[model samples]
Target: MKSNTPLIGILTSSKSDGSIAGNGPLFIALQKKLISLNGISFVFIPEGMEVDCINGYSYSPEENCWKKKSFPFPDLVYNRIPFRTKEQEETSQLLFSRLREKNIPFFNPCFIDKYELYQLLKTDNTLRDHLPETILVKEKNQLLAFLKRFGGIYLKPTQSSKGKGIIRVRMEGPSEILLEGINKQEIYPSFTQFWEEWNEELLKKRYAGQEEIESAEYEGKRFDFRILAHAHYDNYTLTGVGIRHSQEQEITTHIPSGGKLLPYHLFQSSEHDEFFQTIISIIGKSLSEQFGFFGEFTIDAGVSKSGRYYIYEVNSKPMSFDEVDIEERKIENLCRLFLQLINAYPQEKNA
Candidate 1:
């Protein structure tokens, strides 16, 4: 290992022309930060690479540009392959196996399965209370039973992100049902009618049924919280909390789904801050115990009308927060983590 200037690799998908795909700005930002810290950074795809050396784009500090170059296998890797299908490909799997065999540490290797994540957290007694009632919905009976129990439920594709493939159902009356999706809503006379019309969409993907969280609202619209955490050694550090509010009647508070980002201070409280930290610590411990090492992640939670919080999901590959301070801290923590991993930090600092 190059203790003074370790090589860091950012693994992401590539375009057909062999250019990087997704998170372009983030890759550049990471590279620039690494250079400022006197380390080397490269972005690489997982296919058609030699065992000892990789062909990718490396940042040149002197030229202030990314140049096509060949780099030896990096001391540490940061996986940023955005799509689940791409990450599941044979080539990507081979690359992961090679990294493991070589003892090259990486984080967020793959997306989390929604159902599995819920089940894992449900077993943690400390976290169980914050979780909404969730179940795997493979049959109509399962869906119907849950709807009867909760009166309203959310059907989410187990392997999706960014508010995609989510269907919200509300039981307005004993025989009346309301179905909502991204920017779309419908009224059905009965559950049977809705099922007959929507079963195909539900069956098309593996979905999980979760009891709807009655979220705290601002001016008749719902808002939720996103907590970003970075795992420092075995402990997770709370980098920032970002609040996103949904547009009127929207099914989700995800920013891309017609939701607006709000400053955390607009609704922040010391009690909520402490509550979020406790959840972060418990989650960090639970996930690390089950999934080995995780360097960064985000917890999505909703504050109910009664001021109680419910955890909606834990995202392994957290999206970049647009808040300036949060983004800066994210990059700083990431760079420091790389330094820590390669033993590049001073002995006193590490201690």
Candidate 2:
């Protein structure tokens, strides 16, 4: 049933039984956009399926829903695996290897490792100052030393998203420390006691210690910026910047962590805009050079009252933004990338 339409394969997660696990809405939106562009899109789980075909879901325009179907290998594959652990699985790696073996074009192929990306970006002189002071939190003394230097710091899981597993640590006094998590706060008499409870948690997953950005307040609330960018015609373009405001002392300004979204126009500093644009462009190109092709990425950044900006994170698989305009532009830009890739790697009858 495959025809001449450009076929796009979205690589996402699935349950053990091969049912799609997440990103239902995003898949649908992407399908609709591709349809509008005279293309076809389908969601496929890379769980060691048939070598020549994959079991996936495709939109049924007549039924207004997605229907499970067997599809030929797509012209282009867009990696959207939801979790880092899943992306690191042996099966996923095998699938990626197969794609490369067949000479298929894949963009944003995997989730970017946080500490690894930090190490890469810090090597660039232009981006070094814009990054926060960060280190792998492996020992109690290292944490204590960082706290002493910054007075306040944040501990973040290297692979998590949506502000999960983020912690804020501040020196309550010489004898005590204040620890803030997404939903709980506790005061420990000393770093020794805190490490006793947190060391095991850190051992459970990789975590990074970063200096807290004393960001400028909007309406007495802390805020940060999400600068969304995409690769278009071999160059990175800033799609838009979003502002998220913290809710009642929240450790992170992520919407899922109870942060409120603010209009981007509220903070109109031309200097800030230019800074984000220049830095994001640098980051996009750097990532492209370091790691193969990347179609999209979002930079989580904060601005201090002193006008200093810091990049907290860069995510390869960014979540859907709440802003309607950002969503529309993202879809449009993504469709364009798909078209470019489709032309670049024309589909082979057997591949």
Q: TM-scores, in order shown?
A: 0.93, 0.95
Model 2 TM-score is 0.95
> For each predicted model, how many residue pairs clash, with residues at least 3 apart or on different chains?
0, 0
- Supply candidate 2's per-residue lDDT for 218: 86
Q: Report the C-alpha lDDT of model 1 over 1-351, residue by residue, as the tens digit.
A: 334567888998877685678787778788888888988788888984576778888766578787888877787889888889989999999988887777778877678889999998999888898899998877777799899898989999999988898989998977899988887889999888998998887777888899988888898889889999987876788999999988754688887777899999988899889988888888887777787667888989988998888999899888889898999999999999988876732222111
lDDT tens digits by residue: candidate 2, 1-351: 667788899998877776677678778888989999999999887873576888888987669888889888888898998878888899888888888877778889777777888999999998999899999887888778988999999998888887888899899878698999888999999888989989998867889888888888888998999989988786888898899999866588888878999989988688988888898788988888898888899999988889788888999998999999998899889988998987877555454
Question: What CA RMSD would candidate 1 show?
Answer: 3.5
Whole-model lDDT values for every prediction: 0.84, 0.86
Query: For model 2, which pairs clash?
Result: none
Predicted structure 2: lDDT: 0.86
lDDT of 1: 0.84
RMSD to the hidden true structure, all candidates: 3.5, 1.7
Q: What's model 1's TM-score? A: 0.93
Off by over 4 Å in 2: 16-18, 346-351
